[model samples]
Target: MLTAPIERMLFGLSDDHVIVEPHSGQLMHPEALVAFQRLSADARDAGFDPQVVSGFRNFDRQRTIWNRKARGERPLLDSSGEPLDTGALSDREIVYAILRWSALPGGSRHHWGTDFDVVDRAAMSDNYQPQLTPQEVCDEGIFGPFHCWLDKRIAAGESYGLFRPYAEDRGGIAPERWHLSYAPAARELQDFLTAARLRDLVHKSDLALGETVCEDMDAIFERFVRVPERCYPQENT
Candidate 1:
């Protein structure tokens, strides 16, 4: 039941498809907000305050992050979440490096309003800034116990409809334990989104490495954009 209007929201190009969630002032698909509230309530009962790090991001915001990273204005991290020197890297290599942690504009799931990066506010110091890296979720990391709690929730079928798209690294996008995609809506978008459509969108945008991204659109879609069918809530249930 994807409408022409709804499809517009899939590529981070439209603002009409989402509304502001009052509690967090985060823009999201209405259905996702409801489900997220349920998940948050449950997590709070367990002493975890589910704070959203990123919600719905538009193409412009994504592009700024990409272009900045490409110009060395922002830090680019490797697969291990360590900083890499990109001064001598080619534009194509820089594009791939950025994709390891950031999604290309119009290809990102954050555009869909059904996915977001989150952290447990209960574990953060007053001034703590979440890096959303694997190191932060390691056994000894500050957010380790929070992610462990999330693991248990997802495993016990208690995380509402939330699931990790990059739960396991399959050599595509690096694993992100902090990113949660709402299965009901996100699954539909994932299925309906075609590489051809994405190519058209990327070609229209002003990306940092526009030429390189256009040439490698299919590979990007298959590796960075497409998550396996195994990453759904039922698997957890």
Candidate 2:
């Protein structure tokens, strides 16, 4: 099933799924952008200026992020959300740790151009640093109102075809309250990207911790790649 077209589209190697848009200042799937704009307008009308901080990310971009985190060039956090000493962990452990927070190259939802990290730009100070932490979206935090508003509007979002991919803390990835996906397009890709396909790709890819990551393909796939539908946002709706 990992044919050339599948490989290209899944890895973000081709531009078939995305288009350049001035409003996003990045590439996005045309349908997704339209839905996002509607969501943005609705948020604005509700008194929040929501913006997409991250849109489409190709495999190479994700590789850079993975590699940096693996090599300790970037911060690696533990499951408890505390910083970890990557230098002390084995390469295999490093791989698992990275997967807790990031997808492997060619395995990220952002590759689909239908997933994005959104935030309320109006809520932050000009110099506010974005940590995307759980605290930041909690009831007392700065973006708390934004996430609360989103929670109420999520049901209404079905009309626009958008939903959160990580609305809850599933066993695999941490809960990313900011990550939204256009269900209409992303759901197809999700069904197509099975663990077997991901395992084959991981073995062949020059991923940062490829050897260790592939050594336990079944567990890795179950935990990171082959996420169940219950983990998606529609469950909340």
Candidate 3:
């Protein structure tokens, strides 16, 4: 996706990726931002204050997350949301554990500026930080009812072109109900990011467990990176 040696607009590498929006001052595709604004407005009208906690993340940022978890600087959580003992695990094992929660640097859908990790403003106290766990987004969790509301909105096709790509757990990443994607803009980027292209980028990166990751590149792309085709209705049209 990098168009030039010095050019870094794609994947939040350059400053151009970040534009100021009234609610979220993060990086975003123009169309995605528009849809998000509408989505937020609609949520507000429905008595919820939806806020975007995370938006477009750059390659270096994603790499830092991967490397830190790999080197034991950060905690690697399992499918059940418990921390793993990275000290005793193989590099390959650590890689998989990290991929369970996070994406590879170049393989993240957030690179397209069309995805968001959102939470309900009314659901949290001033000091509460969203853990983004399944527990937090389940029926009894803080954002659970909010997401259930979203589920209905998306089902009814009133989500302002947004949908939850990670709403289903398919043995790769866990279900992330808080993750919202602007399908139209995201769909184009998703098609542009092929396993071969991502493998090439990962190989050239300074990511931790580089070789171990490349070994299962195809499966990684299919499992951790690519979401269900149903999320992209534009693809069928």
lDDT, candidates in the order shown? 0.83, 0.80, 0.80
The per-residue C-alpha lDDT of model 1 at residue 139 equals 63
lDDT, candidate 3, residue 102? Answer: 89
User: Top model by lDDT, which number?
Assistant: 1
Worst 10 residues of 2 by lDDT: 228-237
Q: What is the Å distance of residue 123 in model 2 from its true position?
A: 1.1
Clashing pairs in 1: none
For TM-score, the strongest prediction is 1
What does the lDDT read for residue 75 in candidate 2?
A: 92
Q: lDDT rank, highest first? A: 1, 2, 3
**1 against 2, candidate with superior TM-score:** 1
Clashing pairs in 2: none
RMSD of each: 2.1, 2.3, 2.5
Backbone clashes, candidate 2: 0
lDDT of 3 by residue, 1-237 (tens): 446532354344554655555675667767778888888888888888988888888889999988998888989888888878777898878888998898888878787778888899888999999887788888899998888898888887888888888877788887888888888877766766777877877788898889989889999889898877865544311
1 or 2: which has the higher lDDT? 1
Clashes of each: 0, 0, 0
lDDT of 2 by residue, 100-218 (tens): 89987877888989888888888999998777888888878889898888887776544377777777666788888888888877877877886677777767767777878777777
Candidate 2 yields a Cα-based lDDT of 0.80
Looking at model 3, residue 186 earns an lDDT score of 74
